[model samples]
Target: MTYESSASAFRHLLEARRSIRSFLPTRVPDSMIASVLQDAQCAPSNCNTQPWHVHVVSGSSRDRLSQALLAAEAAGRMSLDFSFSANDVHGIYGERLREQGAAYYQALGISREALAERRAASLRNLEFFGAPHAAFLFMPVFGDAVRVAGDIGMYGQTFLLSLAAHGLGGVPQTVLGMYADTIREELGVDPSLKLLFGISFGYPDATSAAAAYRIEKVPFEDSVVFHN
Candidate 1:
């Protein structure tokens, strides 16, 4: 493709990509999954360490992992390699987070006061929102938080974009990392590997309520810096 055409296609792809929360039960083909992973492998990493270690679960394995995750959540069992503070999400970031939550709940017809409903909805993350497959992303710590996290972030974006390119959809769920101990035990993963997140992927259920919602992005001017 020519330069202009290439840029336009890329822009269109980026604009069209969205987090699909609900998916059809139909399984994605193994060949397609392999192809997507191949594309994701091209993602650049700091010093080419290429530290991402992924575990893709499907069929019975997916079901069992979901059940374990749900049980862990219900029992208040959480083991996180990374710390997250609610206090850090203050000011503008917090407002945007709240706004996104409101939009998502509204689209799903969930009431803010319905604690049970909220919990049920949140539990869907463990179920991979009915998707046929889930991939757990893990990486070994390099002692440098910024570089390690940055590599994983690039890898994740590449993986998601590859799914989109293949006419599939995916949603990244950090909540899955909360049950790291359960996941490690169940999947036979090394405890030394830190769980970054999980992604659920498959053909999207476009008719679902959650699929109809799209969070708006801030203006380019607000995020970009044009330095002379």
Candidate 2:
């Protein structure tokens, strides 16, 4: 746990992980998912309450969920229970958002004016974007929100890194919140818990157009603040 070694490990993981949008048809083994969940459980929480519950979907259940989401999205039957928003974008935040969108659409060959096509592409977000494994994460209502949120962030990082280590990839999604009602009913989620987010995991399809997008990270100095 020396500083240098930990930094090296962190850098290596940073280089290895990517937001994978296209996945191969291969199924993710339950054991592997379980192990990732175990890694996620190492995330810190208030009094070690953990406060997170996850529902995993695959096989026919995954397919059915995808279909339900797509149908709802198509019919405009979606509603958002919560959302993350930037009320007023400024400087690097706005720039980063635009740049990422440009890069992604360029890779997919999707023109901005192609409204229907863009809508369809966006609906992919609601469908776990076709990844073989879809996991929905929730937080219990009684827990401290800030602590629970931090726990979720830690679990997410661990889960994504675990997938990267296994030659797999994942995309954590917020759009899934749009179909939360349907998702809750379909998955039999408890009323006391709230949907935190959804993550799609599987072997990435390297040749896919969406997979070709090269997401760039700002240089460390540009984003970091150093003390004298």
Candidate 3:
């Protein structure tokens, strides 16, 4: 692909992708998700090791997973395997995080003082946010973390873009990591392979409150740096 065309295609993709929160009960074809996963495998890796393993859940599996997650959360047995820390919260990225966090809670009618409400809201993450499909991406430690992370990023982008291309929508969820131990045990992933993140996929539910809650992205110039 030529540089111009490649840039144009990427631009289209950016405009097309959305962080879909509400999902339709209308089922998405398994083959479609499968094909997207196939494309996800196109991600580059160090030494072609391709260190991503995914587990897909839907139908009964999805329901069971949701039940397990709710149970774990209710029992206060949820372990924080990977979670965001507010250690350094004075930088640009920190500001961005705060802005989004405030916006999301406001959209959900959660208040600043409602810690229990926020915790309950967070538990929804393990429910795959009510989407029909939940996909977990894992990376096994084989020595080099940087290279594997790069590969994971590529795969994640490919998976999300492929879903958008197929007229489906999803949200890449890091909150799933909050209950990573429960999920890991439930999924029966090998001890070697670690959970990197997750994505919830399905047709967008236009009527849901979350569907209406949206945010605009920063302009391209503001986000990008140019050097010539």
Candidate 4:
């Protein structure tokens, strides 16, 4: 393909990719999963440290982790490797978060006033929204997690894009990282490795409410500046 065509193809995939919250129960072919993993390995990291340590779980292991996550949520168990509080974020970032939440809840047919329903719907993250697999990304702390997290985020974007290229989709669940100790113990991960986040992946169920809507993004002109 010519350079322009190649760039267009990549842009198409990039723009088409979205967080897929509802998935068909069918497992992705092992070969396809392997190919996607290989593609994600190409993501660049600081000084090529390649700090990502990924664990993909399927079938019985997936179910076990889901159960463990739900139980932990019920028991108010939380062990975070990094700190995050919605209240700490404000202005444009917080507004964007609220907007996203509103759009998602609306798509799910839950009214803004339905707090209980929203909470229940949020629990679906633990269930992987019926996905057949989940991948947990972990990393070691070096100095601090900010830079490490940026690398992991890039890795996650590559993984998501690769899944899209392979006719699959995934939702990156920050909620999963809330139960760091639970996940580590359940998956036999070393204590030294801290959980970053997880991606639940499979064929997206187009008919599901989760796929019913996608919100518009801020226009380029509103967020970008040209300095010449």
Clashing pairs in 1: none
Best-performing candidate as measured by TM-score = 1
lDDT of 3 by residue, 5-48 (tens): 99999889877888887788777887888888888888777789
TM-scores for every candidate against the unseen true structure = 0.97, 0.89, 0.86, 0.96
Ranking by lDDT: 4, 1, 2, 3
Name the runs in model 3 displaced over 4 angstroms: 1-9, 80-83, 88-90, 113-117, 220-228
Stretches > 4 Å off in candidate 1:
none
Q: Residues 14-97, candidate 4, lDDT per residue (tens digit)?
A: 878999999999999999999999999999999999999999999999999899989999999999988778888899989999
lDDT (Cα) of model 3? 0.81
Best by lDDT: 4
Q: Point out where model 4 deviates above 4 Å.
A: none
Ten-residue stretch with the least lDDT total in model 2: 79-88
Clashes (candidate 3): 0
Ranking by TM-score: 1, 4, 2, 3
Better of 3 and 4 by lDDT: 4
Clashing residue pairs found in predicted model 4: none
lDDT tens per residue, model 1, 1-228? 999999999998997788999999999999999999999999999889999999999999999999998889889999988877556899999999889889999999999999999989988998999999999999998775668878888999999999999999998888888889999999999988999898999999989999889998999899899889
